[model samples]
Target: MNVFVSLLRTGVPALGGWLVALAARHGLHIDGDAVAGVLTPTAVFLYYTVFRFAEEHVSPRFGWLLGYARPPEYKALPA
Candidate 1:
């Protein structure tokens, strides 16, 4: 799971930047700096949401791959 999360953390930003670069190459009128400012935060939000969801819902075995001992649960704690 850690591996998956790590990959997402890195890959999302890289993919966003790559897309921005590709757009620039194709003569898109977008401002690279402005796009980067937007893309980076969006990627971060996506990565965080995915990671949190996986941590809560994925099987323990797969979670272990990401160094999670177990999937998170919503049960209430002892009073």
Candidate 2:
């Protein structure tokens, strides 16, 4: 389950980035490395935003789908 979750978290962004890069290369006539340079950070930013949102708003069971582990509740914290 963890492995699946991990893959989902990484694979989607990777594939999206690749597609974006490809589109930039072919459709926009951008260079390969330049397209990657632009899209890489964009993809990372998007992934971080999505996962953080999920961690805050979604159930812990589903939060793993975005690669977040829920923090312990207040009752579980040490004094």
- Per-model clash counts, in order, read 3, 0
RMSD versus native structure for model 2: 5.5
Model 2, C-alpha of 24: deviation from truth (Å): 6.0
After superposition on all CA atoms, what RMSD does each candidate show versus the true structure? 7.3, 5.5
Relative to the unseen true structure, what is the C-alpha lDDT of residue 25 in candidate 2, on a scale of 0 to 100?
Answer: 67
For 10-66, candidate 1 gives per-residue lDDT tens digits of: 554456555645555457567767766676566556644665567567643544433
Residue 13 C-alpha lDDT in model 1? 46
The global Cα lDDT (0 to 1) of model 2 is 0.62
What is the per-residue lDDT of model 2 for residues 18-54, given as tens digits with 9 covering 90 to 100?
6656666676666778878887768766765676576
TM-score of each: 0.41, 0.47
Q: Which stretches of candidate 1 lie over 4 Å from their true place?
A: 1-29, 60-79
Q: Model 2, residue 27: displacement in angstroms?
A: 5.2
